[model samples]
Target chain A: MSGHNVVAEAFAQTQYQVGGHGKRIVQVLKDVLNEVEGTVEGDMYGSGKLIADFEAKMAEYLGKESAVFFPSGTMAQQIALRIWCDELGLKKVAYHPLSHLEIHEEAGLRELHGIESVLLGEKDRLIQLEEILNLQEEIACLLLELPQREIGGQLPSFEDLQKISAHCREKGIRLHLDGARLFEILPYYQKTAQEVCALFDSVYVSFYKGIGGIAGAILAGSAEFTKQSKVWKRRHGGDLISLYPYILTADAYFDQRIPKMGQYYEQAQELAGLYNQCPRVTTWPEVPVSNMFHVHVELPKAELEPILAAVYAETGVGLTPYVREYDESTSSFEVGIGDRYAQVPKDALHTAFRLLHEKLQNL
Target chain B: MSGHNVVAEAFAQTQYQVGGHGKRIVQVLKDVLNEVEGTVEGDMYGSGKLIADFEAKMAEYLGKESAVFFPSGTMAQQIALRIWCDELGLKKVAYHPLSHLEIHEEAGLRELHGIESVLLGEKDRLIQLEEILNLQEEIACLLLELPQREIGGQLPSFEDLQKISAHCREKGIRLHLDGARLFEILPYYQKTAQEVCALFDSVYVSFYKGIGGIAGAILAGSAEFTKQSKVWKRRHGGDLISLYPYILTADAYFDQRIPKMGQYYEQAQELAGLYNQCPRVTTWPEVPVSNMFHVHVELPKAELEPILAAVYAETGVGLTPYVREYDESTSSFEVGIGDRYAQVPKDALHTAFRLLHEKLQNL
Candidate 1:
């Protein structure tokens, strides 16, 4: 097997590991099934209590006039920007070069909506307020992703975010928050969801990410914004005849996990500290700002794979699923702490890390 | 109350109705939850056994090399047309003016993909072969909806469909089947899905419609075509982390109902005949083509609403949920027969129709 496969096998074989509770469709929806009546009508084409009530709750939580549930965050964000651009009579927007829209969606913003995206900041860091001021393009909207996920879940201080919001408002540039992990960052900021959402003209949150729902998103903004999104949603085909499966799970998990963010954030910090103590192992951000961070290893993937597999087998603790090669001499993997982290025996976890440290020293 | 609300309340009160099985989300998913294991991983970002196996089954059934599950048929059809347009180097396509793409989707094809649609025929009928031959636009594709829905479920002869297919093939134009209700029309065509699919370059089928699935669609075609669609699916954010909810229900309901189309069609015809016998009442095409037909009542909505509501109240057999005003003098409502038809007591249904006939005559 290839090195990646070997690491994956080790991760899969172990009884104890890190990450969120499993994503089994059955397990994710088990609790939700009990709460719903079999005879109750499911929402049809976005009209029914199942979806409307959840949207209302999320809208109130985010302090927006209205919110619309969407099939995916990608569709919601693209539409959010498209709405802003259409309103401003400009088909241009700005976001970080590493934003999911810029790099991950196959340039859907450009190809599907004919909207041009202006890359805002350098790849490795968050978008600085100075960068927003220096933007050469006359952009209609600016999109900022909270806890910039591609950069190891790094987050800017809340004060900086406030300044950026003020500047964008003065410039007449609509600000949209790509807050896919919005719930995860709340503990670090020590702020309510409403406080953070208040910084932008529009916001999107993913239920499947840190909340551990099956899949869905909430695009919240003004009533007019949501009404327009409904039309664009139909255009994008995001309006499923029934979105209750997503809504039900999102409601269950959001309520279950939102209050536990502080716990997960502390667990992530403790876990990252264990890795940093090991030889040749380091974590981006040095300490985690939320429930996730990236791990960089000094050894190449080919050289490091067997050692990691051996550690998992001997210690019965899986550290990472796969180590990705950055170069022939370096590799990395991401770790996100959740309910699973609490399940690992503390003694076993420490022994696994000690073994991991010894193995790296030997290398 | 408004006329529409009165009719709606009457329909809601009746225990019997003429439509498919109820779309209660829990009921639709109850059986599926039992068959799946809680530990089995849900598909993540379109990866896992749950989605893959279902896609394989659909592709095999449709006689295609591959298929992909989509969140909605609107996204699938738009992406299918975009693919053909992209491959042919022409951003133009053709379909009936009342095609879902032309009317229902807020012109997503034109707005999102920059693709132009050439309307092929009059609003009141399916596209004729002669219209295909006389197309004024050099188009990349032609979309055909079996049992054309908007025109009251009318269909041309199978021989006519074959000729249109042959001509489109010869002209180098791709043919796509908007087979939203492909299974419903099979008894009339006397062809298996494969034989019907053999005539088209691509196909999109909805699970939520006649199948009574919660919501989902399948886009099937050549391996290359499906591969391209996957990319577009991601772009459109149709790739939910787990589509197993849809996939499982679709698999169950499709198997449960595929054998019942002939039954539903017969029920529809019988139901239409009763309406045709009533004064000033007519069925579109005056015959049922599939399991669905439009009922046109030659009275102003204001006049027809109370009469129909009274019939439902007196006989406890609801013929329709609402009547749509076509004009001040005429109103229409669609009826689709499914499991519910078998539930309505025969004696009550006859009495309901007799009452409906007497009321219409009194008008």
Candidate 2:
């Protein structure tokens, strides 16, 4: 299966698509209105009690003794790395090249936190233990994103992960997990959330991305660390009042969707198996270690647009968030298995791929 | 007027008593649910845009060219001062000691932007042109808060304001208006909102403080300045999506209450006149230049609490947000006027003050 075909298949199964259109405005309105009237005073100055409760609950759920919520994952990660640097008396964090904290946090770590990043792994490779071992010193923390979102949701092996965690502990380097997609990765790794979190000194999770909550991120750590983090949270203007709505939504989703992550993992396995039989598409990591997989399309960039449009028009689903040049102008696309993709039959993916292949072959 | 009398009079005018005796939870819930929504998208990202049109309209109403919305007046002023600093290559902003930006922005200008502030005028006096002239070097900007919330809602005379504006212009220092309570000040100033805004390069206003929207602020400026501000807005994570609810509420209040500020102003003057005649109570600035006025009551801390509690219990209205020890040993109280306070007749306040005086004298 080529990347083009992979994307075509994914587009044939968008969950958000309702009869080939957006969710109804009335539903959106109802949800939004509820948000406007929060459980307590949601203003910045007032609602201190609500914020305290939300933070406390977030801490308990994340398996940390304490936590503080931030407005964004960018701020949470940047602040975590900064804390690690200050604590370890070092200036650099070792991470993979595709880390979200590095690429998408808008240079905030460099500009705001004044910490440097050492990109340790090869551009296409995950941050291996070898890279961690090569650094003798000058590293404050080792950041690992389980099921890295950017390079297709691939996770390091459990044994490899244990080694990295142990190495960091031995070296007195903190292990910080950018667990934005940790919920999606849990079932694939056959681990409970608490078990995985035990490996890291601090973990940052986003409520908005996979949890379906409104915007917020929680940085969970030791009680001492989180207590100190309150000062920093206030300084950054992330100390919001009345976070009950976000917390309630996260709680509701935590029970319903978290248990279904295993299902997504199973569905992703089936989707990957369908692609494995095809020659044109090469799957990254051979198999997705999580609910998402990236397909390297062996097609020209010029053919991507029309094919994608045709797939959406014919199948009434748009799968990919973005398609771009991966190497030497060759196009690549990433796909993630969610509720919508699970609804589409595996045969539709096969059919979608065949149609995409026919279209690309003509080009 | 004695603080005890004020408290007693406050109780005598009660529509209902305190301890959940005044307002029913059902009524509170109904009003809140009907007026506000349950889940506001935390749309801090482009939430400003929903109010962008309203802000532009406000700018026009205030006789300005443009406006940008902020979650806080502190943020708005700090960002404005930062822009002035960046634009003029200056390191310091001049403001009064009690300026909210200097005291309340939590030292963000110094900690985050590395900019310094020079407090002008007497320690607690309205900013004067004489203080501006005494500044040793070029400064980035000058901040003036009309009816300064911290200092008993005081404002300078129009002639004095014009003089200060001219002085700043001659010195090439940008002038900014911290108009969080500007609406309340306008009727007392007997001038249009435009007249006040015209004296400054930037003006900031609030929604919840006086206009009584749930929570939001606006920063009005020139189009070019606001364009640069949009970039800053995203940098600060202030861009929110779908701010229609806050916008709609702000719009409703702007139309309904803005014109009524004059009435509040008239009531404030009457109350000030009544308080000035009292021996134990001191009214600052002689008369309030706005709907908000602060009364300094020379009462013992222990004596003040019960009377205030009684007032709130009997009247179902707040006489003060709190009782603070200006000096831990010396007892002092501050009174702020709100819609509730305005509804209480001057004689009620006089009677409350008489009761307070009698109680204090007996003590």
Candidate 3:
């Protein structure tokens, strides 16, 4: 009950997922491969026209002078920070404490690249402008993760972001955006991907997250920056003999999902309202700025799991199998609305939520 | 005539290749995916049954206690070296001057890992035992590449290799094998893959090279070493969400081609003999020790290219599209014999060689 097997079993028994299911993912990859004609070149190394074309398309979409594809977002972000720090001859970078680089990447920036991080801002909140102003040490770069994922997709206002960007410019510190969910947040800002990206010196986007590619990320910036990144990419062993599968999937997903961000965001808001109505349930943000928000319930994961399982058995609709424990009696889970959620009629979604609330009350 | 375009054009028109064609590679990937039933789980990170199974198979084949998959040989080897150097607290690694880390990786070992290299031997030759004895500094690891790829697939005698291995053991230095072409060289050593690997503390092999996988490398060693490598691999951004494609292709190729390496080596010897009989041509070692050898033609690449093109046009037999320039007049190209080469009739191959010699003599 406490290992990966439990999670795997829960996921297997679930009838629905916010993201596309395994069969759909495989079909997408197969379809993309079929659509692209001619022999897939580049052997085992990630080169050839396919990779070049995908990078070019991403650069054009992000309104950057150039772009490079990386096998993972962790690598893309680390390399971007490394390039900025090395160029300025400084090793100190500033970012929110909840940043992926700070918390998830095992401090590779410090251990591998010899770059120190100056953590700013409070936990579970958007980094305020004063956090930047309060920094006394000379930092080479500042990384901003839009709609901070670890904190329930919270985002700063457009005005606050612009002020932060202006402050970094005044201080001559490079700004890098960990825009892993940039597309998901764009609708709230009423901005184009390029408009949001232009505020930073470099931007990284994950194709596999909201865009639903199997795996890949694109780092876009000025031509010089991207050119240097390629060398670092090679050094980091990020350069594969071929990235055709990831590239084709990313391309297909961009076309299918990016334009519909607004609808997904609206669905998230509607979903949040349903959770809010249940006296035992509350949302972290009370509303969603993007297509994702965290839902907190009074019951712990152990008690909540079986109730959800019972609900699924009775209604044929699957809620989350487990919740992330927040306290002795409270737990939370992220609700990520995508094309799959959008396909379900609103009334069915309402019935599912009601059944979950009723089951929780009985438990 | 001198750039990649010419090479691409020639390859496009040629009916034969040292490796399987693009369609065949794609089909193999598809076939493997189809054969594996059920959802290939692991989410967007490589931590599932497929990756574990592949690693286990590789470990068993290499006679190692454990093995791990890396996205690139460059990353796998660098991580292996880093672990060894850190354990010994010595930053210096010994390798041949023409080693891939020394010449091809843009000094990433020094720049990224802070590991210095003690160049061990002359170019196009194996590292001698005397070279190891002469080193003054405390060395962390000694890297040996089987069939020394950069020098047209050259290998030392078994006795010499044993001497070097014993010396490293005596010095208490870690021995690492850059066994990228391990399978191809096995026939010459008359050793099982595990037998050759047993001499080294750690060994790396490329799936894309002899095994004909799309892209991946395997690093094998003791379970403790491999466990440490997983952390390093994650830090290097090598843990993909799914490595199903690479694993499946590797599994398929290992079964199909590994048993046929002896035949490939014999064919390489036959091909080298034919080239040696031509007055304008010479094989680098006069004979191949593996399934590949360097072909040095007396004409410059520019002079030889058009003649090869003419032969391809008239005889439907494809000579190499271009040769790597060795000097002002002489040029060299690697002739790698694989299953694809095994498909070509001996008479057709001889015809291609005869026509190439006649055209080159005229030029």
Q: Evaluated with TM-score, which candidate comes out highest?
A: 1
Provide DockQ values for all models, in the order shown. Answer: 0.75, 0.22, 0.50
The model with the greater TM-score, 1 or 3, is: 1
Q: Which ten residues in a row have the lowest lDDT in candidate 1 chain A?
A: A22-31
Candidate RMSDs in Å, in order, are 1.5, 5.4, 2.4
What tens-digit string does per-residue lDDT give for candidate 1 at B1-363?
353488889988997886777646576786677776777777877777878899999999999999999999999999999999999999999989889998899989999999998888898777887888888779999999987898788888888888989998899999999999898898878889999999999999999778988899999999999999999998898877788888888998899999998899889899999989999999986888899999898899888888988998998888888888977899998888888999988899999989988888886
Clashing pairs in 1: none
Encode model 2's per-residue lDDT on B1-363: one tens digit a residue: 444555455555655321111221122222333554443322345433335567778889878888876645655666788788899998788788887656655676775567888888765567665666677866889888887667677778898899888988988889999888888888767789899889999988887666766445788889988777666544444443333444555667677678778776776677677666655566776777777666665766556667666646643544453566545443454444445554555455666555555554565
Cα lDDT of model 2 by residue, A93-147, tens digit: 8888888766655555675456788887776877777878788657898889987
C-alpha lDDT (0 to 100) for residue B144 of candidate 3: 93
TM-score of each: 0.98, 0.83, 0.94
- The C-alpha stretches of model 2 lying farther than 4 A from their native spots are A1-29, A32-47, A88-91, A240-256, A271-279, A282-286, A325-328, A333-339, A342-354, B1-66, B237-256, B270-279, B312-318, B328-354, B357-363
Per-residue lDDT of model 3, residues B263-360, tens digit only: 88888888889889876899977889888888888887777776667777666665554567888998788777777776677677778778877776
Highest lDDT model number: 1
Q: Candidate 1: where is the Cα deviation over 4 Å?
A: A1-4, B1-4, B23-25
Off by over 4 Å in 3: A4-11, A18-28, A42-46, A343-348, B4-12, B15-28, B31-38, B42-44, B360-363
